[model samples]
Target chain A: MSYMISKATSVNKALDEAVPLCEPVLKIREAMRYTLLSGGKRVRPMLCLAACELVGGQDSTAMPAACAVEMIHASSLIQDDLPCMDDDSFRRGKPTNHKVFGEDIAVLTADALIALAVKKLVTSTYFGVSPERVLRAVLEMAKAVGTEGLVAGQAADLAGEPMSLEEDKAGLEHLEFIHIHKTAALLEAAAVIGAIIGGGSDEEIERLRRYARCIGLVFQVVDDVLDVTKSSEELGKTAGKDLIAGKLTNPRVMGVEKRGNIFKGLIQTRWFR
Target chain B: MSYMISKATSVNKALDEAVPLCEPVLKIREAMRYTLLSGGKRVRPMLCLAACELVGGQDSTAMPAACAVEMIHASSLIQDDLPCMDDDSFRRGKPTNHKVFGEDIAVLTADALIALAVKKLVTSTYFGVSPERVLRAVLEMAKAVGTEGLVAGQAADLAGEPMSLEEDKAGLEHLEFIHIHKTAALLEAAAVIGAIIGGGSDEEIERLRRYARCIGLVFQVVDDVLDVTKSSEELGKTAGKDLIAGKLTNPRVMGVEKRGNIFKGLIQTRWFR
Candidate 1:
């Protein structure tokens, strides 16, 4: 936990310095900074740093990639909270971006952040890593956020809203698809990119990718359990909102205990290794 | 016009092949393709290809970057026509993206396209250009689309809506700022990137950049003039729509004839040189 905290602190500082509120577009910049600087667990960056260190790399070597992952994550959250999407009014205990900046600016804010994330990765001259590796990481980040990854997961999840979970064989498979693409794909990319940028061998990168996949699944399952068991206050977000939204979740498809056990088992296997 | 047409055809083909409708996110992919494949003049791509050729580079060398600029342009148009933005119902004689797909999908479609644009640029192996040049082009594209460029222009444009244009020095400066960043920045990027990818000297690149800046501004001024002078049928889009929406434009700042002369003078100087 302390390791994660230290890494998060470094990431937050870098992110702050990276995206300042400059002139001409101060409103949109503020909107972007408001959401990006909002406190989260910084799990993705932590995972990236951990993967880099596991492969004998320093934290500075992975900082840009780490920051890029968090920026992408922030942009995703901003879009998810728009009135056209999840329609949430609060995120991380603050009013959502659209709620504060209006929908037009919120949309632009997300777009800017996405562009900035790519810019940061490609333009960062401090990489102790090679340019080819940096380019590969940029490509990986792009793929993770596009139609083949997060957008695909989101589209499928929306389409599956009408599906009946009870007595449906395809429900479990569909749920897995959503979780894997929506959650695991980015996490997997984060770890793999960190490893690549940190100069890890192809085999080591492959191993980290697999490990992150397991961790990503466990992260989603735990989220499902928390959504069912925790209150909105406890979770720092609207708990059980997924259920209310008629979205398919692991705990809803299977019992909470079973889902919890699966989460625990996956975590143990990945972490112990 | 024939030269532009040939370049447009090649660009359209590359763009079509770049973003195919695959599984899992077919809906969003369709949404992206719908807007992208719906034809435009492909002005930015033509500029990129032309600049590349001017610098002794082949068409294939600049194809990916050309496609990328168009993708970014398409994404911007999609977002600009959203309900919370310009709220336009039609673009290029077709219904806007959100009018066909829901607003949620429309937003995601734009987001996906932006990510894919970056991906396409970085992953293009046919680049006769060096990796450093490709990376520089990617970085340029990023800055062109982010807060300091398009978003800044957009936000300022929106905010300046309530400001009275008469007898205001700031209004003219603001209008120029908006047009320079919003329109000229991407166009400049397209040409500069093409030149870089084509292995142009620093002097050549700078000259192309200046020429592109002039051309981009002229393009917008011509658009403003056409909005007032041409009918909807002639323009292939809703004419006088900017006036109705209370958006600031070049003709709105100056008279139509004055703006038209400025546009003509810009084109003559840049092209005839």
Candidate 2:
């Protein structure tokens, strides 16, 4: 926990310095900062930093990629909360971005953050990372968020809500698709980017990619379990949201006990490895 | 016109090949292709290609940058037409993206296109351009659309609408702020990216930047003029939208004749030079 906190603090500081309220678009900047600064676990950045350190890279070398993943995460959350999408009013115990800034500014805020995330990676001159590596990292991050990544996952999740329980169970393939693309792809990219920035060999990068993918799936399974067992207060979002929304989740498909076992098995396997 | 048509044809082919309807996200890809492949002037890409040629670079080398600017332009237009933004029903004599795809899918389409635009530049391997140049182009393009660029211009444009005419006129600096950031910045970036990809020297890139800035301003000023003077049929968007929306425009501040003279002077100066 302390290790994660220290990394989160560093990521937060870098993020704070990254986006400032300035002229012409102070409101959108404020909107971006509002959601970004709102506290979360900063799991993506932590994973990125961890991957960099695991590969024998300097922490400073991976900071920009770490920040970039967090920004992408924040942008996705903002978009997901919009009236046209998930329509959630609260996130992390605060009013969602669209609720505070109105949908127009919220949309702009997401757009700006997405662009800024890419720019941050490309313009990180202070780190002296190779341009080729940075370019690869940017590509990884981009692929993670585009139609083939989070967007597709979210879209599939939304499209699946109206399915009957039997259909959903039969649609396990589709469920895995959403889980892999929506959640795991970005997390995998986060680790891969850190490895690239840290100058990992291709073999090491591929290994970390697979490791992060497993961790990401475990993360989602745990999230589904928590949704059933925890309250909104504990989760910092509406608990049982997947169930309420009729969204397909691992627990919904495999039953809670089996899901918990799967989660535990994933962690134990990774731990022993 | 023939020169522009040839450039547009090549750009269209490249853009069409750039985005394909693949698995898991065909809907969003269709939404993106709908807006992107929809016929427009392709002015930004033309400028990019022209600047590349002027710098003595191969057209093939600058193709990716050219397609990127058009993608960025398409994204801004999609976002601008959303219900919360310009609320337009039509663009270029066709239904706006949201009008066809629904707001949720439209938003995702815009987000995906923006990410893909950056990815296109980063992953352009055929040209053998330096990673440093591509990275610089990506940064330049990203900056052109973020808080300091299009989003800023858009936010200011929306905020200025409710102001009294006198207040808006008093805010001419603010109006220019919108024009420069919203319009000129992307155009400037387009030329800069072209020059960068084409391997122009610092002086040449700077000159192209200045040239594109002038062209962008003239473009917006002409747009405002056409909004009032031309019919909707002629303009392809609602005529007098600026007046109806109370949007601050060059004609709104300086009067149509003076704005026309400014546009003429801008073009004439560039032509003579």
Which consecutive 10 residues in model 2 chain A have the weakest lDDT in total? A264-273
TM-score, candidate 1, first chain: 0.93
DockQ of each: 0.79, 0.81
> Candidate 2 versus the native: TM-score?
0.95
Which 10-residue window of candidate 1 chain A scores lowest in summed lDDT?
A160-169
Pairs in clash, predicted candidate 1: none
Residue-wise lDDT of candidate 1 within B91-179, one digit each (tens)? 88899999999998998899888888988887555555666787888888988899867887778777767346574467667777888
| Per-residue lDDT of B51 in model 2 | 91
Clashing pairs in 2: none
Mark the regions of model 1 whose C-alpha exceeds 4 Å error after superposition.
A264-273, B264-273
Error of 2 at A3 (Å): 1.8
Encode model 2's per-residue lDDT on B1-273: one tens digit a residue. Answer: 888899999999999999976655788889989999999999999999999999899999999889989999999999999999989988898889999989989988888888789888875556888988888888899899998789989998889854555674466778777888889999999999999999899999998988888888878888888899999888777788877887888777777878756666666764225
